[model samples]
Target: MRTTLLFAFLLAALSGFAQDNFTITGDGDGFQEGDKIFLSYRSVKGFIEDSVTVHNKSFRFSGSVSGPVRASLYRNQNPKYANVIFDAATVYLEKGNITLHSSDTLRHSANAGTPLNTDYDELRAALRPYFDKLTTLRDPYELSDQEQKDKALVARLKSIYHNQVDLMVPVQFSFVDKHPSSYVSLVTLSELIRDSRWIDKVEGSFSKLSPELKSSVLGESIKQKIQLGKRISVGTLAKDFAQPDVNGKTIRLSDYRGKYVLLDFWASWCGPCRAENPNVLSAYNKYKSKGFTVLSVSIDEKKDKEKWLKAIKEDGMIWTQLSDLKGNDNLPYKIYGITTIPANLLISPDGVVIAKDLKREALHSTLANIFK
Candidate 1:
């Protein structure tokens, strides 16, 4: 009876161990013995970290995790390779074995294991071809010198890039919508929120997340961004903010309250913002006498004041321009949740945001209609 009881206890112990532990094996061509492979996972409490040593061009990591977690891999001595591994070698660690296969350069990798990892792999698989297509399209070497110098070619490339971006949004948002319970959805939403065009979709996805996911740190942060979104949306009152103009005098958004204001957010370093200045200038020229005025808010830092002023003069943007020289952390950007710029809000005489992100012909069209 004693012998039988001891065997039963050992079997139970083994069963518990199998339920709580995970193992990862990575195989690549260039890793040498004793090289370290680091792993980190995001959890509710924060990131949990672990590492293992490479031996014979391979490495293995084994540990117990409280739950299935998405983790990334990294190694020492090669920051570029580490980025590749981080970007493509993510795996979901659960109570099972995970495997990674990579090339000598770590430029490409594959993961097989838990469901989340499988989902991630599927996403990458679907998007990889599109990315390759974009890379091909963007290859300047493929263009003739004359074609490269053509302004129309630059405009065409920008259009192609924007169209590609439009295609990516639905694919990523579909993943989030279909997998509301998955933490991967949160990651997808985070990426989508970086573009102001997708901010509305991010808000839509937030309502669909599972309770546990909604309570996570990322979820809460996204919630706060949504709140900021509300504050800046069209029809809401544009929040008043003050910053120093190029001449170091204080200017407030409220000071322009009685006039139709083109509240513009831009930076000296922004190529798109610089490109769009002529359209803005044209609108100002056409509409300034008719109660509409452009109040430019620069997100440029104090260190870049010279460049900011130079850009103003070069672009011929003769208007009320203001910046605290605080870059992105400036009051206007913070209050308005302004991420990407060349962004603008058209404010009415009553201080309500009447329109936003008016670009190129749209700015001219809107002003023509408004002042007509």
Candidate 2:
């Protein structure tokens, strides 16, 4: 069974939580004083992590930007949020054609975005004004310290996220989707799609991408499980799968005819599966007398056949347990989308997966109700 973590994170700047930011480090630090420093950035117009890396010294000043970028200095600043930027000798990148760079590579120079491999005195040539505005504001009494901090942090990220999303996706998508072999879109869009309103919109856009990009985009992202209130409902004929059983016996789910089957996807190593073993064992004991059968598919590693067989005997598992000892590649794990452990499908005598994620207690009652 696979252990998957659900996604959590709001759209950055568009959600209004991004700190103003910028940076400038070009071609072995060729920039000089009176040189124009230009900054234009966005927040999450593309992917959250996507951003541009600049290696140019002469940059045009936007004077005005899309998502809360600013132009500020290193030296003269307030104490509170001033820590947000870098500091240089009495020199500040505040005025027009702001000069940049210092004798000490360790010293702060001019960069609006996050700095790496540099000490203090680094100025945020980008988003300077926004940080300035933020620092100048008096702390509001209504908001608690933590609350204010949280609000400020989100605001900062939003500012960056919103400005970059558009540029990031188009350029990155164009470059990545260019090759049939490239799978950047899938990786890129995976973080964007969710089980919410955004699903349709994201899916639609994904579908419109070039054929080369489309498959890569949807590969791992599409939700296969039955979500509550989703268009895909319970009682639907489950997808058929072909997997080999123990002793090298091939098992096609469609081949199970005329008998109700419980395709239980589990592993001996999974705690949840082991914990629920007793309930399954109990169910087997009761239903085995009534013609119901279980197919315990183990995702144990290839070398652990003895361990797999031993776990079954130790747990007193009496039903038909099958495993190829190939871990995740076992039949049921792939056919049924087994990203989680201890998963089961209560198939009718005809082979339809009736229920999923059924806890032991619920499984017992459900079986009783169905059989009765």
Candidate 3:
């Protein structure tokens, strides 16, 4: 009788472990029998990838995750053109029997039978209208080069885009507020922090998350980012750092003390940075005599030093340019917690950060007001 009881308990324990596994089944009318499907997600061990060929317009992937993880599923038509992803859809990978259905492109795929996925679908549905409007407003072919150069027209378009995004922010906040324990909520908050304007609110929302969620991997990352954000936020003293210039002469941020400086962060490979160089050059030329100067810090890698020098000459950026040639690991980048290019801080002569991420008309107007 004792031996039989022990066997029963062992069987139940193994059953519970098996229940933690996940099986994902996909059904798509667009998928042919030979079509290939790819799944990618991060695990405790790091990034993991799996692939399977479609059988009878369906595919399946079985795996286990330590916790809820955001994952992507897509089809790559040609292995040689791996960069091209088709019918891609994002789904949360958790323990469950999840189903994906798409009559056409997976971009419009629907997921069900999973807690995180259900919440994600609901949130996406709620924000679809705003996203649609923003998409239409930002259609690249909607404006010609000449039309893009029209400042008034561009400003009006930008105003509309900002208004749409403003309305969408609250929906995301509501989702997080309603589902404090959901991994989807944590992911949403992480994205919200990217816009520095929302840091305060993001921090507040982060605080309200369930204790378990707060202790999650992504949660800790967001917490660190929030701390970094506050450290470099406006009204704080800008941290000083030194880097080597093209001449291999080390220069310090403190060297520019007593002068208004636009401490610019950029890289040669960044398209937006290259496009904004003309504006930076214009601001430097107009304000250099008025106690204002530009100090550009390139995040280019060691191999791209020649490209960085070429871009400077091409853009006619005559002000001081510096780089440690450490790619994204440069000291100043870590000090300021810069995650994006074409970012700049307008620092006062006294070494306080007066403003940040100033670009286009805002950059000109701020300098004009200061030098006026």
Per-model TM-score, in order, reads 0.67, 0.40, 0.81
* lDDT, candidate 2, 190-209, per-residue tens: 54442222344445545555
* Per-residue error (Å), model 3, residue 112: 1.6
In the range 1-372, model 3's lDDT, one tens digit per residue, is: 999999999998877445257888988888777888888887767888888888988889998987788988878553335755646888888889988888975677788889999999989898989988886787422578798677457656655666777899999999999989888999999888876667789999999999988887788989988887776988989888989998999999999999999999999998868867777877888889889999999999999999999998988888889999999898898899876677899999999999988876678989999988
Q: Could you tally the backbone clashes for each prediction?
A: 0, 46, 0
Top model number, TM-score: 3
Clashing pairs in 1: none
What C-alpha lDDT values do all the predictions have? 0.78, 0.50, 0.85
Where does model 2 exceed 4 Å of error?
1-233
Best by lDDT: 3
Candidate 1 lDDT by residue in tens digits, 307-352:
9999999888899999888888989888887767888889999999
lDDT of candidate model 3 versus the reference: 0.85
